[model samples]
Target: MTEKALTIITQREDLPQLFGKRIENQAAIEEIITKIETESRSITFDIETKEGQATCRSLAAKIASAKSTLDKAGKARKDEYTVTADLIQVDRNLVKQRLQLLQDEVRQPLTELEQREKQRQAQHETKLAALGYLDVQDHDRIGSKFIKERIAFLENTVIDDSWEEYKSQALETKDNALRILRPEFERVKQREYEQAELARLRAEQVQREQQEREERIAQEATAKANADAERQAQQIAQESERKEREAKEREARLIAEKESAELRAKQQVIDAAKRERDAIEAERLEVERLEANRQANKKHRDAIFIQAKDDLMANGIDEETAKQVIKLIHVSKVSNVTIKF
Candidate 1:
């Protein structure tokens, strides 16, 4: 039978219900398809005529064009949104596959990232709540450990000879702040120590000066008494000589002169003793002054070394380097000593 005369069979919904007027206008498209299929089954011309095949192909192509035109007018070429919605219906499986890929490569990762951020925020909040006592550097150090990513961010700063520069360097690497703080600690302690030592030295000096003054007053009184005793002995010896009128009296006067000589010699001995004591006291004061000077010089040198080292360390120099600098600085300070006979 001719294909147009053959009934079309389908398990899907009836065609008229879906197609509306487009189906009536393009009815020939289906009729031609049916005719081609139906006539192809018959061997009307023996050996399957080539002309009939060509004619059938042409009719199939024409049907395809008519169906395309009808589809464009009916539903295929609707407004952009409408056609897109219709396209979604036709391409559901392909779109679903693409969407699944996006979920795996893009959407899924984004969702997981958000989840991780939420978890991280909760953990950070707990840590932050616990870290009320820690400074910024300490807090970041803890964060470096607890957070999944290391936290080492710090803004760049201009460094100079000031303590601010050292503080900035210390903050840049929280772990190495000790390098800066240690020098500063020593510097502070050295300053305090020097001040205390200076005060002590001053007190000792005042005490030494008082002792020297008292010693001077005592020596002057002893010298005055010795001089008075020697003068009185001399006057007695002169009076004894004047009284000498006889040989026995002259002998008595000579004896008196011998006694006077002994007294003068004794006074010289006492004066020598006083001189020795004064010399001893003077020597002691000199020694103390020398010692005080030595200590002051030492403190000054120590202060210089501390300042230099602290400056280097604050500027991000390592301990070994700072030590070298300090050593050189210490070495450059030559101590001068003078000796006299």
Candidate 2:
């Protein structure tokens, strides 16, 4: 498929004119645009080199100059048409303004009458709204007296010729407002009575509370006085008992000190006598032990000597010679010999 060439070309063959004047440079402008479009196809630059960068700037300046020339040509061609349109608009506005003034002059009387009628209707609406002002409110501040006055005012108000066509509506609105306010008056009275009763109860409650508080204060004062008296008696008793106990303790301590001193003296004497008897008994026991040891030694030596004499007689030796030999051994006069008992 063949791709379309991106180029500027004038397709219309109609005569070039703006605001009944010939576009003298229309063909020249088309020729310039085509030249620029053709030149744009050849535009090339490599920013890495100075010459290429200069070529890029030169091509951009040429494109900008071509756009400026085309813009000036278009503005010059449209300026005449714009001035003609402005003249037409000014003539049309003048004609419309003159016709409007004529029409207003013709309708002045009827307009004034209509405006007065509108004002009268607005006034009637306002007055009718005022008659129905007793509509139920979420937070009603109207008291019973105010409600009664409003009801009486509504009942006495005569809907007459002054109300014009709204007379019946005004009378109905007054009746309805009275009907609502009359019942509201009774409710407001009940609420007021309840509030008064509540105030009365609160006053009585405050008085009773004050009396009870005073009684409690008096009872507390009496309790404090009795407690003070009892505390004083207890303090006195404690003080007296403390003094008596301290006196008894002092007397008892003195008597105990005297008895302790006497007992100490007696113990010292007893300890000394006991020590003296122990020393005498120890000396007597030592003497008895030495005498018993000496007697035992002599008895053992006599038995040994008798056995030696008997043994020598059995061996055919005479007793007198054995006796002499045993006496010599006992005295250790025999060499390298001993008699063991």
The model with the greatest TM-score is 2
Q: Lowest-scoring 10 consecutive residues by lDDT in candidate 1?
A: 147-156
* Model 1 lDDT at residue 237: 65
> How well is each residue in 138-179 modelled by candidate 1, as lDDT tens digits?
332233232212221211222233323244434445434334
Candidate 2 lDDT, tens digit per residue, 17-71? 3212324623333443444455454555564466755554555444444344344
What are the Cα lDDT values of the candidates?
Answer: 0.48, 0.60
In candidate 1, stretches whose alpha carbon ends up further than 4 angstroms from where it belongs are 1-245, 329-341
